[model samples]
Target: RRKAGWVKERLDWFEQMSQLAVDREYVSGETFLYLGRQYRLKIVYGSKRSPVKLRGKFFEVNLSQSMPEQDRREAVRRAMWRWYRAHAWEKIRKIVEHYSARLGIEPPEFRIKYQAKRWGSCSQGSVLNINLRIIMAPLSQIEYVVAHELCHLKYKDHSAAFWDLLRLVMPNYEVRKENLRRSGWQYLL
Candidate 1:
């Protein structure tokens, strides 16, 4: 009975994550998240070099007016990814610099990309792999993830020493970690 219950729970969790991943659409007034804040998407029909820009509280997606709705949707998705990736790189780099200085180590090499299951990881070679989706999370949560990975530079494993280093660098990391755990699904684009 316990095994059946565990399987049912796992299936339910997968269904929820899948639903969130596939139900996203690029319609105007549809809301998106960034830095733990919600911003509405505004579809504007016009020609521009860049397809998307965030203005005030809305993400303006500029497209050719005559473009078909299906094509426009795909364009919006691509444009959003471009915008998010650029911003994520900028923000994560700065954060990494700030934490690395505090940790008294030269900033390690890093990459921002899509990772289906990890927020961030540190390799044996000390390269940091940060998920681009983390841009949608709050700045504090982003800091926690970066700090956690950076701690791996000092202690390769999540032993007590590694966690101690993380805590020393980020005193309130536990709260940020909990927030990410509870609401991370909503950050998916």
Candidate 2:
């Protein structure tokens, strides 16, 4: 009877703690909501307290305390997208110029936008369209995407030659590509 009572008491305590955790709101100022137990603001993770600043090379996350009335977390996410558009364009342009010269091909027009399923795309006209969300990724991942698209200028399809070209520029292209795929969804939220 004593052991049973102890188990029941422990179960009740656990339930109460779980409910408290669920009710806790991690709102910070007016721009961000700190999700998860820990508080951190990186290019990949969005939070209410994240400083409205861009990190190294790639990755921009919004840290705002006000404006949108929606979930504070969503507001921070939207701000991150805006930051990406405003800042990432120039960096991408420079990368395209560098790769185009190396490949000896006319540089294609580049555009960045919010894309759902793709990190980047190359049209028949050789115009390269990259997802602005990539601005939230690591710089190496961004470079991998750029190199992948640039290779398309040589081979329209993902042929063996295409992989070879990508490898020539980025020896660890495969690893970076996998990382991008695995963590890309973190930016979406």
Candidate 3:
């Protein structure tokens, strides 16, 4: 009765949310984002070397013929991650250094961490973690997040000193922050 009804309602909601899960499928022709731009995906069986690379606006995946279908999908997933991590590391590192130097703040120990809701976070030990998925957003937005966490190294809370420092670093940060919040869900995939 009551318990059965509650179970049924919860299952219904779970089913709905599962449909939007990004890793559920590896179908060809799906689109992916990089630096705020959408690239149409094309998966084709090929020999070796590059598994995924962007040509113009298309995300072309060349799967090794020897790999099984499931392996091919995993390779595509791994390849995309490698690409994102490389780009994110290069760009975010520079942004952190730039902001830290300007504020006379030592660069906090930084690393990339996957997170659901946050783009960046600064822990008590001055460790700054940036979400790797953030690389898929616009560079300005990425810089906004970098400035934010770096500011946290100075002022741990979202206080006036923090806001003033962030504003000084990124004049257009408010716009970038809003954009990241409004559209970040698309990049979660």
The root-mean-square deviation over C-alpha atoms between each candidate and the true structure, in angstroms, is 2.8, 12.2, 6.2
Q: How many residue pairs clash in all the candidates, one count each?
A: 0, 7, 0
lDDT string, candidate 3, 110-175, tens digits = 999788878989888889999999998988889889999988888899998889988998888899
Estimate TM-scores for all models. Answer: 0.89, 0.61, 0.84
The regions of model 1 sitting more than 4 angstroms off are 1-21, 47-49
Candidate 3, lDDT over the whole model:
0.82
Checking candidate 3 for backbone clashes, the offending pairs are none
lDDT of each residue in 96-170, candidate 2, tens digit only: 877777777877888998886789999998889998867667777788888889999889999999999888878
Show pairs that collide, candidate 2: 30-65, 30-66, 31-64, 31-65, 31-66, 32-48, 33-48
Cα lDDT listed for each candidate = 0.90, 0.66, 0.82
- Candidate with the larger TM-score of 1 and 3: 1
Better of 2 and 3 by TM-score: 3
RMSD in angstroms between candidate 2 and the native structure over all alpha carbons = 12.2
Which residue pairs clash within candidate 1?
none
